[model samples]
Target: MKIVVGSKNPAKIRAVKDVFNECKVSSKDVPSDVSNQPYSDQETRQGAINRAKACIGIGEIESFGIGLEGGVMYIGKQLYLCNWGALVTPDEKIYTASGARIPLPKSISDELQLGKELGDVIDVFTKKKDVRQNEGTIGIFTNALVTRQEMFSHVVRLLKGQWEFAYKN
Candidate 1:
């Protein structure tokens, strides 16, 4: 079976590719139809589902569409990073899973509260360009003990595992 990722982001694509190594995985530019920085788990999971559904059957090939989304949410007064993933089969069966979350530093949370995207805020925070495409804020916060790719991969694994359990035939 073929697999397609909804975004061209290397980190997201790599997670799908790495987890579904036995399958042919590719990437497409699909819209998530959500805010640049989703501020809640519901919106973040919706974004992932949107992307996953949008990427189905590209080039008329039977495929699995995978979507990875990163967002931030507040649990009380603290803001935290949240990640979600979705897998959509050619038949439109949907499976979703959430991944690691870490609290954001006040400085970054301040920027997010200002309506700035975490990608842009993280770039400013790290004095680096395209940090989201790399290790992401999770990497910087955890000192690379965990990475954006790994977090997404964890979600993908959960998605696939759930799908398998539901439709193991």
Candidate 2:
């Protein structure tokens, strides 16, 4: 099957490609239609769903759309890094899933609380440019044990598995 991923972000595209190696996959820059820094799981998941839903009729190929969104959420009082993924088929059947969450260091969480996006804060924290396009905050926090691609891939797998179970007989 052909798949059209909702974002051109390398890690997200790589997750889809890696997880769906047999399919013809392509990506487009679709709007998540949410705040640049999604503050809760609900918003993050909605961003993914919106992006996926936005990908319909974008290209000539009959394809499914997959979206991956990363953001932070406050659990109790501590903010944690979180991510979600969504997939939408041509028929508009949607599947969604969330990935792991890890507590942020107070220093980073404080920066986020200051209204800075995680991607921007991470760049300054790691002193690297475009960390989000590379390993992402998950990589730095987890010491590279869980890369951005790996995390999104887990979510994509869940979405794909759910779709398969629901649609494939």
Per-model clash counts, in order, read 0, 0
Q: Which residue runs of candidate 1 sit more than 4 Å off their true CA positions? A: none
Question: Mind sharing the TM-score for model 2?
Answer: 0.97
lDDT of each: 0.93, 0.92
Model 2 per-residue lDDT tens digits across residues 38-57? 99999999999999988877
User: Listing every candidate in turn, what is its Cα RMSD in Å to the true structure after a full C-alpha superposition?
Assistant: 0.9, 0.9
Lowest lDDT 10-mer window, candidate 2? 54-63
Clashing residue pairs, backbone N/CA/C < 3 A, model 1: none
Q: How does candidate 2 score on lDDT? A: 0.92
**Residue 125 displacement (Å), model 1:** 0.6
- Per residue, candidate 1 scores C-alpha lDDT tens digits across 15-71 of 998899999888899999999989999999999999999989886568888889999
Candidate 2 segments exceeding 4 Å error: none
lDDT of 2 at 14: 94
> How well does candidate 1 match the true structure, expressed as C-alpha RMSD?
0.9
